[model samples]
Target: MIRLGGGPLERIVAVGAHCDDLAIGAGGTLLTACRARPGLRVDALVLSGGGGEREQEERAALAAFCPDAELRLTVLKLPDGRVPAYWEEAKTAVEELRGRTEPDLVLAPRTEDAHQDHRCLARLMPSAFRDHLLLGYEIVKWDGDLGRPTAYQPLSPGIAEEKVRLLQEHYPSQRHRPWYDREAFLGLARIRGIECHARYAEAFHVTKLTLNLGD
Candidate 1:
């Protein structure tokens, strides 16, 4: 297998359609990266759930997930499950974030996601950050929308456990869901780990990647 390395990840942008999306999809990756690179810059944007309890949940969750990074998050008030209707507002938010930082990596939803809000943001991302390494993170749902991902971020057993722990700790609002349990998170990680020959991992769909074989 050929490995592609993205050098010196000083900054990253993580966008989500709603609260808990980032934590569910990319929390382990965020924990692993932030631990390895202390003081990393993490800029996050959530299209909905602002000015409410969910926003509070997201802020606390991301802070814990990013660890020592300089984390800045924006949660908007757009109605949940209705992001496409607010296209102009969502587009402006993404564009403004683009104007602020040229991130080395971007963590976002996959265009093929079953959720409309997630798909909307995923489609909007490429328009703003055309040349960046954008990793489309996945959220398991009742729709059975999991796909074969092209990229893997291997997480240690400890990191995987920590990710689950943090998810449980930070997002109290999500606990009532039947699917929001330890088994669901760890089981997915275990499967992805088996695929990548690791103890655990987070998988991502890469729409495009540029390989540089030269030093």
Candidate 2:
């Protein structure tokens, strides 16, 4: 595999339509990056589940996922599964985030996600974050909406296991769901790892990226 390097990885922005979306989609990548660069700045925005149990779980989960990093999170009170109805609020929130930081990378849901909430947020990202590197992360569900990813973040055996452990430990509210098991999480990671020739990995869809190929 040909490895490519980018500019300094000091800051990143992670946006999700729901409370647990970021953790489920890009937890391992967050873990790997934060560990390597202590005090990395991570700004996270979750569109729904604020001031409730889900928000509580998300705060704790992200704190654990992003160890030793400067993490700032905002959880809105938008109704779940109704993001499109509150389109203006979502767009304003994303624009506000854009005004706050110039992130080296942005992790968000895939534009083609089966879930309406995810798709709505994905579509709004580009409007605010023009000229930024936007990576669309995936979440596996019964809808079977997984698609080919253009980028991969390889995780070590320990980091991969740690990601699972953190998810299981912090998000007890999600445990009742049928798909929230160790095997399911690890199974997806394992498959993505195979694609990138790693023991474990998290995949991402890139709609646009500007390569710095030695000018």
The per-model lDDT (C-alpha) reads 0.96, 0.94
Q: Which stretches of candidate 1 lie over 4 Å from their true place?
A: none
Error of 1 at 76 (Å): 0.4
Clash counts for the predictions, in order: 0, 0
Report the backbone clash tally of model 1. Answer: 0
Candidate 1 residue-wise lDDT at 143: 94
Per-candidate TM-score against the hidden true structure: 0.98, 0.98
Off by over 4 Å in 2: none
Error of 1 at 6 (Å): 0.9
Candidate 1 CA-lDDT value: 0.96
Q: Which consecutive 10 residues in model 1 have the weakest lDDT in total?
A: 1-10
Report the lDDT tens digits of candidate 2 across residue range 11-102.
99999999889998999999999999999999999999999999999999999999999999999999999999999999999999999999
